[model samples]
Target: MSDSHVTPPPPSPSAGRRRAGTTAALIRAQDTAIPQADRAGSGEPPTPAQAFDALHAYCAPALIRQAYLLTGRHDRARDAVVRAFRLAWQRWPEVAHDRDPAGWVRAATYDCALSPWHRLRLRDRHPDPPSDPADRALQRALLRLPPSYRRTLVLYDGVGLDLPETAAETEASTPATANRLMHAREAVAACLPELADPAALHRGLLRLGSAERSPAPGSRDIRTAGERSIRAWTRCALALTVTVAGATALTLETAPTHYLAPVSPGHAVQGLPVPGSLGPLSRDALKLSTKLRKEAGGGPERLVPQAR
Candidate 1:
C-alpha cells in the first residue's frame, strides 16, 4: 500500500483517527471529476470501466459520505463506495444511457447502508461506547430522524446530493425527497442545543470547502488532473498485480494437467500408508480403527472362525 493509502482502524483507541485519515485519503485518491468524453458517440457505449472513470469524478464523494454517515465507520464507507462502483461497473452499459448514473450509485449505496450485516457492524463498533462531545451531538441529531428521512437527509444535506438526484437514487418521489430534506434539516436544527459552538461548526464547513477546492499541501506541484490520472493508473496496476498473484498461486497448488505415466499401480498398494491417510481421520474413525486393529491382532494362531 502507498503511504497515502490510510489503513483501516484496528479495534482500539486510534480507530476514529484512522477512519478519518482513510476517508480523506480516499477522497484525494479519486481525483473528483467525471467527464463525458467516453460517451457512446460512434457506436456502443463505453464499457463499465470507461463509464466508472467518467462518473466517479462526480459521484464518488457523495457515495463515500453517505456510506460513512449511514455506517458511522470509515472503512465501511470506503467498502460501500467500492461496492457501489462494482455495481455500476456491472450495469454500466444500461446505466451510462440512463438519465442519471449518480442516482444508480446512490440507490445501490443505500442498500449497502441498510443491510443487517452493516447494522451489526455498527453495533459492534459502538457497543457500550462513551462518545466525544462532537460525536454525541452528531448522533443526537441523526437519531432524531426516522430511518428513511435520515437517509434522505444525509444524502442531501450531508453528502451534497440535490433533491431530484437524491430522489432518483433513493427511489423516492420528488415530493418525498423534498419532504425528507426539510424534515432532516429541521431535525438537525432542533438538535443544535447538544451541538457545541454553532459558529465553529459553520467555520468547519467553510474550511472543508476551501480544502476541497485546493490541491492538498505537499502535493501542489503536481497538477490535480495529472495526479488523478496517476492515481487511476496506480489503482488499475495494483488490481492487475493482485489478480496475477492469485492466479500464480492457484496454478502452483493445482495438480499437473499432464501426469507422468502412472508410477506403478502396485506401488500405491505396496506403500504402508499411515493410520491417518485421509487427511487426519476424525476422532471416531481413529478410535474405531484402533479397536478393529486390536481385534485383528489376537495371535494369528488363535482359533479362527474357519467356516464363518
Candidate 2:
C-alpha cells in the first residue's frame, strides 16, 4: 500500500488574529525606533551616512525578525521595518555613539510595543481568545496575568531581552521588573503545552517576514491605500477647518436677516438696503453669526457635527 499522507490543518480564525496582532505589535515597536520628522529630512553627512547604512544592514533583518515574532502580519512588518530604518538614519549621531546599537534598537522596539496604541490593538484581538477548548484555557490563563507581567514575558522569553535590559525598557525598578518577568515566565510556562511549540512559532514568524518582503499577486494596490490614508487624514483636518469657516460665514450672512426679521418699530434695517460692501463690524458680526448657526446644526453636513 502507498504511504498515507497527512496535511497540516489550517489555523483557526482566532488563532490567526492572535498571530497577526502579535506580529503587528512587534513591527510597530521596531518602527518606533525611528522618528517621523527625520524620515523627510534631506541633509546628510558622508561619514555618518556610511555608518548609518552599515548599521541598517545589520539591524534590518534582526528588527524584521523581532517584528515578526511580535506581530504575525506581513504588511505591517514591512512598513514598520522601513519606518525603523528611516528613524535610525535621522538619529545616527546618538544611536551610532551608543555602546551597543543592537541593544538600543531592542529597547526602542520594546517601548514601541508597550505603547498604549499597540496595547489597544492587541487587546482588541485578545491574543488568547476562546475559540477551541485549548485556546479557551490558554485565554483564561492569559487573562489572569497583569499587563506588566505579560510585557515581561514577551520581552524576555519571546525576544530574549535580558532581565536588566528588559527592566530598563519597561521602566519598572530592576527588582520589580525582574519579579514581573519571573511571574510572566511562570504564567507562559504553565500554558505552553496547550499551545503550539516554540520552534513551530519561530518558523511561522520567518514566513511572515518573508511574505512581507514579497507581497502576493494583486496586492500591490497597498501602496495606493497608504497614499490614500495619508490624504484622508490630511483632508479630514482640512475639511474640519473649512467647515468651521463656512459655518461662521453662514451665521454672519444670516445674522443680518435675524436682527432684521424681528426689528422693533423704531429700529430700522440699518446700513445699505442694497447690501453694499460689508463693513468690518458687519463682516465680523456675519462671521460670528455663521459660527453660532453652525454650532446649532444649521450648516451643511460636510462638517463633523458638534454637540449643541
Best candidate, lDDT? 1
Candidate 1: C-alpha RMSD to true structure equals 22.5
- Clash count per candidate: 1, 13
> What would the TM-scores of all predictions be?
0.44, 0.42
Badly placed stretches (over 4 Å) of model 1 are 1-48, 122-132, 159-165, 193-308
For residues 86-185, what per-residue lDDT tens digits would candidate 1 score against the true structure? 6566566776776556667677777876666755554535522114555545655565567687787555545445555567767877776666656565
Give all candidates' CA lDDT scores.
0.54, 0.51
What would the per-residue lDDT of candidate 2 be over residues 165-256, giving only the tens digit for each residue? 66776776666766665555456557664335444433433343343342321211333444465678799999999999999999988776
lDDT of 1: 0.54
Candidate 1 weakest ten by summed lDDT: 8-17
Clashing pairs in 1: 33-57
